[model samples]
Target: MSASSSVAAGRGAPRQASGALWQALPFLGIFAAALILPMVSNDYWTLIATRAAIYWVLVSALNLVVGFAGQLAIGWVAMLTLGAYTTSVLVAGNVMPPVPVFPALGVAALVGGVFGFIVGLPALRLRTFYFAMTTLGFATIVTQVALAWQGVTGGGIGIVGPVLPAPFDTIFGFYLFCLGLAAFCTWISANAAHSRFGRSLVAIRDAEVAAESSGISKPRLLGAVFLFAGAMAGIAGGLFATLQSYISPEAFTFDLSVLFFIAILIGGRGSILGPFIATIVLTWLPEFAAPLVAWSTFLYAALLLAIVLLVPGGIAALLDFRSRRRIEADRTIVPRPELLPEILGGRKASEAITLKDIVLSFGGVRAVDGLDLTIEPGAVHGLIGPNGSGKTTTLNVICGFYRPETGSVTVDGEPLPAAAPQTRAASGIARTFQTPKLIGEASVLQNVMVGGAIRGRGSFVESLLALPRHRQDEAMLRHDALLALRCVGLGALADVRADRLQHSELRFLEIARALMLRPRFLLLDEPAAGLSAEEIRSLGGLIRAISRQGTGVLLVEHHADLIFEICDQVTVLNLGRELAAGTPAEIRAHPEVVSAYLGS
Candidate 1:
């Protein structure tokens, strides 16, 4: 059988539903045990199990912020404390009608969201160690305030929490109540991880510049994740307080915050089930080691250190390792036959990009000197120069990565309003980097999916709920992305990890991703950098096909033959200044261009 047919047959042979069921069996078993444990186990074990459920809610939210969003917020415990204290104050003061425990939970979420927003404002500005330090500072500040505030918080003494009416007041009822709530929170997180928002977050975590170039707003998305995580922490806190029937400053500490971080790291950062499993293990480990009480804390620390040192991807990585290899071995790439359209049929034609008297400098060095260039629609405009001739720098200036100190960049006749990567991308411009910036851990399909982040319309809530609009957008996105991949000869490799691609394949993958934008103008930097002679020939054909589609192409290439073959016009630069510009034949025949650039 052909390789493509074998791959298609192998994938089509599997019962998708049965595979999903097998994957979910562990979670189902856990839920079943949670339901029956209270009846079969002793009271102490039941209490431990109940507390584990609450921890699961908090840790799951943390996973989104830390794992996928790539924010190290160790101060999440402060939000939890705020929620518990808010519930305590309301119940003790009899401020509202006693309508069970749900109202208190709602109030806690509001309070948590507000505080989270407040903290995220300053915290999001910093990254890595600095961000962690800022959050750690907040944790310390909040703890001190809780201890010092004698009037409302009852000071170091503490306050009592309201009972959950009658039925829920009992241990069995409360255990069941927490289980249901934990499941709901887990469901929300699982949905977010698979949605467009989740993909954007992962992209931001992996490559901020690439993510922004694809039109994702990093700060805005991170703020929203911080807000959601804060709300979840608050809800978990309220439940904890109600279960214990008391709240004290001692319960919420910096140590507890670290524990939450440790749980997710040990379980796995990005996976949905990792935090749940980690919480159960960390919560009950101490109880199980009660006989060795003196060494319990030491044992916990040692185990965590071992996990960090041994399995950096967490326990989830180990479980997925064997399955991953097996899948890769069995997978076959099926090439798609449909090529990019010869003409951009119905799509609006791109206007010319004119750079007038462009001059860009870095200190004493002028990377791009006063130069005028124009790129017309439906043509390959090649930019050629020696090593330091500023070819790539000129592209950067045009694409908004660099702003020329003395030049006006215009589309058609109007000047661009801003020089932000996202803004340019939104204005019908897309680009590929010299290094081929694909997210290594992401599947080829997912890396391409990031191309349509803004184009895919749906709110975070709508996505979580799987609303009609969200589903429709997702389906359309998948189909379009697959088509783009096929056009670049990568349709069959969509399920493969991007890191596994060969050097030449990575170049094509980058082009495929850019094509998903349906860009009016495409910027290609060193698109022919690492390709073999045969690949370069194929690339020439692809560029021609794209240009015929009425989309403008700004190609920066070192291969003179390739440039002259496909490019209608060529501009040559020397020492950061343009030396010659004309039709390919005219520029190639110029005496100075031949002597200084083409070769002696």
Candidate 2:
């Protein structure tokens, strides 16, 4: 059945919050266990728990980069070591009187952020193993420097971290402090996993071009993530130094780097609590297996291999199997109509997009040659031509995906910044690709939510904190996304994964996503490439509806019948140059267009 028709029949109401509560029950149980264990455990066990808490903080931080952002950062230990050394040197060298615990923690965070920014700046440009190797180099350098810097770090011996103030001086107090800090870190990590920043990171990780087009700044967000993660790692390091009352170069080894790296892998990437649990188990597992001390390294290696091979998604994925099913089964959603006007009325005043003398070439081929087009608000302008006529290239240039070798693009009579895709998108241009560009793993709703990102709902900080602004923005985005989905007749399947969508559904979903942006202009590449005649008719109606909402649509399509039936104006291209420009009727009658594109 058609998704919307099924929705009208009331077949897809969202499931209750009970499903969500059930999913979270295990984590709540774990939290309760964590609290009670400290109260009942012996001193040795308590110490191990405390150490696990510290590593939990570090592992969670690393997860943001490796798990969420998909940046393989192995140099986090450097930040951790930096925090330890910075705190120890300050207190031990008497550079400052042994500050209170909170203040010491603050200092460690600052140290971590500073070094993290430095490392992230250069590393953001590289991807995959190259980035990993860069981080590995940074870790090596930091470890070597700690060993060599005798005056500051006490050479290989290392300086001592300051003890906590009187109230926290006892072992129980320290353990409590570690537990509280770990809990705070967990909260932040969990918040980030659902925040705008998190979504943006995942978008970038999955599709860089799509993320950029959605107005996400790759470098800025990544740098911020690295800085935040680094600060957290540093905090963990500072806490560890205080817990042990000692620090040394030998302690922060490449092996330590491997451990932190493995913790996230064994737990699962992109999960907040998964890595937290992995950190605890990995931290204490060796202590429990004291008899296998000599084989500990081999055992860890085996475990890593096992997790990577047998359960590549890690323990969290296994636990989340049921939750995944619940997510898939969730179709109980009410239609949101309030956001219709907000999305439809994208442009208040009349706006026009003008492309003048545009020329874009790749190597020796002139993809778009001296193309001039005008798109008026409240109109559909179709650009049609034979294969390789540069229809898509022209749209790319206008939307800032490709910079023209020599030309200018103006929106509402002002020069549009075509230097970056994000800039163009922010300036009221949104686009859909020839092939549907959607985050496969993300739900249909989430794919649309990405479009609403340009609406300026909240800041990164507000998103992370889940503040009122963030909630308000999220609510608005969700409402608008539903409206957009309904507009394209896919509201019933909003909860479905984008990858599971049929080709026709995907095309409509892409249009719905673009509409969520409430864009002044839309660059649509082949909206009817693979659709039935009925679907094409539906798309034409949707395009006209969008035009009525005052959105200027630049459609690059080959479906001549659909284009002629709906387009207010049409521009025909052939061999990188304009073949004809006029109303659909005029273009159809043009001799040159018929010979070149229409094959008369």
Candidate 3:
């Protein structure tokens, strides 16, 4: 074989950074202050820092949805109420006034999470401004209920919560508790940002429909993130309420929700330290400048807006780029000695995917009717059809993006349920879109990393703990992702954001993303739709290499000549029906195929 190309070096290419601090010294100072509160300060300072830490978690928690998941939530204050009441009801044994601490904190986390789930239900049926309105409306109703139902919430004044348990009563004890919880929330949020679960959130944000096709359940994943965020926010609220010995609707407001949005936009959306940095500045600057506090708040707002408009990547992109680059550069990459016999990589001619008698209906229209097809292992099967002949519809049904009205989709001889798209993907199927769909808001590497979510030593726990094995596994995956990007001629642009890629490069990037799945079979829909002749030639070579390696590739292409040159077998479709299926030579000579091509 001609020298096999290895993109090991390309995978480690350096990335340009926005030059912001990756790790914040200021946050480190705050962290140290939190742990040593009683030793250095009196009761008042300790309480202030404690409350600040709690607010820090609030912003971080909200970021999961508004920042990372790309959903705007205006009812976040409701979480505070849910948390305070849940904790009060559980630990405050004095049923008369309800005033206990420890158990309440734990229960608050749980109850708040449950309530968040309930509140998030509307997210399933709503999106964009409608979802925002729903959340805002819910928050308004919840606040009204809290105020009107004074019997439980102590009326407009709110409830006077009890002190925590024995150890927690002391300033040091309470300070340590607040700090630890804040740290825990930060660590978990950061890990989720890097883990498979986190990538799923980004995927959902980028494109919910595409995310489903890639095997991520939209509702379940969205609920999980919301629940997780709710729990964290509840902890913060519970702690803040306990520190002050009071809770009320007056304390939480819509302004707080807007502030979190501004903070994430300024500090960076995905970084753990972003919220900490933004919260500290927002919380302290006004306090220190009490004389002109309102004006100070206005200034902060202006600063946040300027950052969003100018340095859109936020502080995390500016600060962490070099650190991530240095880390990526220090790893070694080894090309597999032999490509494996899997869908995304490693294959030799074999039968892996087969489609028989597939039919797709969109209400009144028949997109695909009685489509019979078989894709063998190590074969490049080209699907050719005239306008509206249903090539994409066939791919959609097979991938579970659309369920066929009357047909079965089988992978390796097993039929998958229509609703289970992720199951279909997990069954070893991967695909690229005609229009590239990726999480553009995320880092270039993270966008592809979403597909490299196979489980191994790098468990979610390992990533959270930053363990040795997890780091190693993460390094390996990053290397492989870069290599895959280069395989499709996108090596130089590995670190460039997908949204910023040129037209031709976008096509390659889409294929690069699918390759991250390590699929057993792949479906390429119009991979050459917008490519020039030169790009198309290179793309043809790639299909051949993929076929030679034993990967079964089903390609849907509009360019008839390119299909003939690249595909080993060709299937022609007309009016949603398979007109002919044969080798390229046979297809070129068929009378019926000619008639379809030239008009019968």
Candidate 4:
């Protein structure tokens, strides 16, 4: 297990490991059973298995976004719809002036991914219901367009899709074809859930704001999820069209979206086995419901309601439940004494984070009023005044979370934006919040993977397709993320959940994440405010090493004792302004500093 892909949890994190594989066994058995399914050999059974497998692929694709990433997607069927319709049009013998069928299917999937990317771009700006509403609108719009377009989409007439020429005609051949696609997709989705890219999705899903501040680009990560999910939906759709030997606008409707959600929830969100269970049960549901067909609706509704009300987190939670000790054993959080010094060395800095003519205001408050200052790169710079000294406000302005009213923030001539947070981060400015803003449910490795993506390549499409280049790039990022955790002395805690870490560890982990952006400069809000004396000294040293490496680091620490002991230079703020800037010794002796410290 390289650092980036480890499973994390321990101590405070409740037991989850024992249940994971125990639930997975059924899938193993099912796969084994499926091998014998083809042996049943009869056309009737083969066709049923084929249908189940096709839906299985659909469920798996939805799982990537809806389950693992925890994003509610109702429009998943849209991509599949695009794939089926595109394939129908291209192979219709009249559209596109003629093209081979297989290439058409491939083209259909690619086109679906492209369209899905367009839909997801808007998701970056919205969240929760707003996000869901945006996707739903997209689904509704596409359906209306398909319904209205008579010439290309065949209007309400639908489409008579092309068939596989010779080798793919029989049920056996078709079953094998669908099985091949389902198997490939299942492997892709499952492996991804355990890999760096998948971890990034989980991080974004868990908390977009924290992920962005930690150097993970929210737009790109979300887009990657959308593209991968879309490709899977497209692949499944094409197969469904082939299987039915026909398709229509009605085939991809609002209810299909609901079905996708139900499968993930019932199967277990974030579990590899969840989709399989959901798919099997759903594929056979109508037949099973046939016996009680009249009362079945009532019974089904009651059962689904019970499942939702009782096991809210999903079936994966129930199936993967295990004894506490076993769960603790799986996550390797520990003392990790060997890594302490390297972490300590990272803080001992010599330069300051400087803001010249910095200004910010809300209405007329002038929260930060023309702040002029420099924080020595490796020094513990303190911004202190009475209440609302604009300490936190200053941090926000420098990191680009808020646009300053005026003045430029320059770090060795690398100017920061007055507005855009992302652009500032790309220029090597990274920061943390007073609150530990981490994705609580995701593993430590996963959260850090989001941080590490700054160095990765390939847009959403390439990664979903598992192009050789993207795969290689992901592997490299994983290696780098692990190395970063190790540098901060959190290697053993790689698999631990961020929410489960000791408060100090969470603080360290945040800095570790910031480092993963490979920033030439770091802006730490307050790393020592919550730590003990030993931890404070450790923070001091860490700042120094980061400075020594030529990466400027600016720290705002409240603990003047720690600050004075470690900072080569210090700048103090009073009444929303820079009181003074100088070497630690000079400031400590200055009359104004003496008054500020003594409260004279």
Candidate 5:
């Protein structure tokens, strides 16, 4: 069997298993050490270890936000503080009847989730430093409220923490309880990290436009993550209050927030094990050097700077020894067009994607003017024009990236909502960018899997818990992603980071990602821009093969020869309007096409 066939046959299963084992080793070692710590260390050490576990319960979930989603949520300590106060006040019976500790913690989680969603609302409209500032502001407000609410919070005097009943009341028992909870948090977060939702988060971070085209709703996904993270943080706060036996505004400081945020950065983004290790190390650092505790924030800042300058990928990069191995110097993309049928799976859409009298403008310039086009299933349609001729613009219109002033995009004669790019994937439209937008830090296979974000049947909760439906979603996506990779000739490099691939390889990678959608209409935007002549020929062949499998291909390219060789019908655009439309032979001889586009 061929290499691709071997891959499809699950010959790589052992390697995958081995890789998974390696990934699990560090986490296993850490948790095992925590499990056995009481036997090896004193009660003082137990307290410190317990503190680390409590902090991890929060950081693990926050890793999904700051690390995976790339949202700068620096004020997550606000959730922790809120959780602590709510748990303490409810149990103290200051305002209401006394509540049990576990029940109070549960209520704290619910409250945290609501506030977390509120804090994260600005993120939907804001970005980067702006969102970070909002979180910090919220943290400050929480502190002020805790200080001013003297009756329930006890103001500066603070409130008594809840005491657990029976076995969990002892320090050792409590340590074990926190450790177990931390491990559970780690397991769930890791499950999410490996699921479609996890890959979608990374896609949103690095390739948002592509993510949108693939049907990842940033608002929905981010909102869900914030709620989960906040709940976890709230749980951590309850545990932390019990550990200290007191709850106060002073305990949840900005320094604590810095420690949580820095732990993720120092460990790495998109890695559970790295941040887990970082959390333990940072928790123990202050105890190791007592004098450094006063300058904890400064230490975190300095460490983050060093990590940024020296190892940008953080501990995760250091641990990824596989990436250090050199890929072959002379590599070629030998796509298996025959495998198209298997990947496409005979799921053919009978209707075409049609745009009628589309008029889109930017300021005073009409980017696309009175444009009408149709991409029929089982065919290749070419859109060709010179610079600024609105070829890409027209593709964007169909994809819902841009709302046309006067036009309608229809799939099977049903009008699609305007400016809703996230809806395109469900409508059976998938596209590639002119410049490949990909998660550089992610594996090629994972990047391709991002295209199938909408295809997963599992919900976020299912993914987080590793439920049956989530596992099935993952298995199906993984098998199809590998198939798509093999189809595009990137199967061998499936484990490699996407940024490591060559420019030509990235183009094919994008196509492979697009194929994951099983799109009825696959739109290519200047796909042949930076490819070699040979690679372009291979691309043209692949495009034709995809069309033959019942996928309507709308190829916007500058390579005239490629268009003539493969496209069934060619549409030539000049100044946002169709200048000529015919078969390759007819367009090749037309006087207007010859003068305007082909040559004088």
Candidate 6:
């Protein structure tokens, strides 16, 4: 690494720490105000504040699901209902011997986590409105079950809430207890929101295919988040029951569920403080106008509509002044080939990525048929053909997005598992889409960081607690992502939102993201699609430089000049079959190749 690069890396540390602290300020201020509420407020206000605190405990975790992961879990109140009833019954000894208050709450949380996983299972196979309906249906069933199960849940008459012994028995004392738990919840969830797992969640929400290519398992990550969120909701329910001193099926209304979901939306997707503040505000709004309590759902809907119309990005967007700053109009992507060695230093793949007799068809029409190709390490191999010639399909097959009917894709001569895209990154394969698949709302730095998600050694628990291993993983990813951005001429816009970049810049941004993999085989699909002449020249040089650094380059492009210019070997495809394969010079002059693809 150059001294200048080291200085740049060093300079990023303090800035990142400072930025984190800056983000922390809002959360600190909110909790700090909650701490002092008892000193100035009366009993009624204190109770209201306590309710808000309890609600925040649930919202803090739900933010990870609805906000960060972008799952529409509208009926989360089911978790709350389950938690409330479970704690009430256990404390009342309705099903067995009486349990202590804390133990009852713990049991409730366990039940919630289990049920949460069950509720979230549908999300893996279902999408959007269908998933939302499933959650809503679950909430309905829980209510109906509570109403019918008279022996255990006390039916319509309801059950008494568990009261904590001493220090938390008094109204204000109980408020303090709830407030403390709320603060603790804030800390842990915030820790997760800033970790690699958090980034992967956002990536999964916004760019699932890209997330998968980066080795993010949607089922595993979503399952973990659902479990955590459900547990928190359960804890919140126990607290809510205690606050009310009674629990009933009527208490956990669908309207309440709407409020919880809306709070996250009003606060903004992928924001902790936004949802935190929204939770408090929404909880207090009904109390402020007593008549609004009856029409809470309507008011909530109105508020959400207003927020969407006035600020589509919600409270988070309003708070983000940094992104509103104007970016430079004149910017150029000057690829730094020297940095290639630093990023790709340890990546040494001995064998090529080979495809043997591959056959993939859709609706009996072959997309790739009887194909054989090898992407050799440290070489530029270009695949070119007319439209629907299976160039991109071949790339997809190699990336494991599509399974071939009869073939094998191997790395180091070991066959890659068919139909498993997430395993490709581990096999040292990384690729960019024909159209750039990126998390537009996230920063350029964050989007690039997504590509290195599999590189993190920390577990979800480690990230949730902000443990040493998680911190190390974060620092390593940040440094490497920065290095990637600098190499691809995107360092200046690291903090900028990806959607704000120009077409050409987005193209390079994809390359920057791909570099984060330190891939042994880098497959690019028409990377020169939207580039200017000079930009295309720079991209060609970067691709060639990456190939020279011991990474295999599979270039799928329509630009004949670029193919002939950067590629050492060229293969032309026509109707899912190879037309010609030779050195670029030989392919460029072949009579049949010129007539078929290069143009007469």
TM per prediction: 0.92, 0.91, 0.84, 0.83, 0.97, 0.98
Q: How far does residue 471 in candidate 4 sit from its true spot (Å)?
A: 5.8
Query: For residues 1-600, what per-residue lDDT tens digits would candidate 4 score against the true structure?
Result: 323234332321234346446545676787777768878667776787888888777778668777866776767777778888887788885456766778888887788778778887766666667767877888888788888887888888888876876677777888888877777777667766765566666666766556566556666666777776776677677778888787778877565676676777777776767667777776667665577755644554665687889976566656644311123433322333344333334433333456889888888777888888775443345555445777788888877788887887876666765656666656666777777667666667666666766566765446656777676666666555566687776777767666667788888788877777766667777788678777776777766666666566666777777767766667777767777778777877889878875354
Name the runs in model 6 displaced over 4 angstroms.
1-7
lDDT of 3 by residue, 311-405 (tens): 77777667655434432322221223133222244333334676778888777878888988888877899999787888888887888768777
Cα lDDT tens digits, model 5, 419-475, are 999999998899999999999999899999999989999999999898999987887
lDDT of each: 0.80, 0.80, 0.71, 0.69, 0.91, 0.91
Give the poorly placed runs of model 4, Cα more than 4 Å off: 1-29, 41-45, 68-70, 94-99, 150-154, 268-271, 291-309, 319-353, 457-483, 544-550, 585-600
TM-score of 4: 0.83
lDDT of 2 by residue, 59-107 (tens): 8777888887888887678998988887777666556565666677788
Show the lowest summed lDDT stretch of 10 residues, model 2. Answer: 328-337
* Best-to-worst ranking by TM-score: 6, 5, 1, 2, 3, 4
Q: Candidate 3: lDDT over CA atoms?
A: 0.71
Which TM-score value belongs to model 5? 0.97
True lDDT of residue 352, candidate 3: 60
Candidate 6: global Cα-lDDT? Answer: 0.91
TM-score of 6: 0.98
Q: Please say which candidate is ahead in TM-score: 1 or 4.
A: 1
RMSD of 4: 5.4
Per-residue error for 408 in candidate 3, Å, reads 2.3
Segments of candidate 2 deviating more than 4 angstroms:
1-23, 94-98, 291-301, 322-342
Candidate 1: residue 340 lDDT (0-100): 67
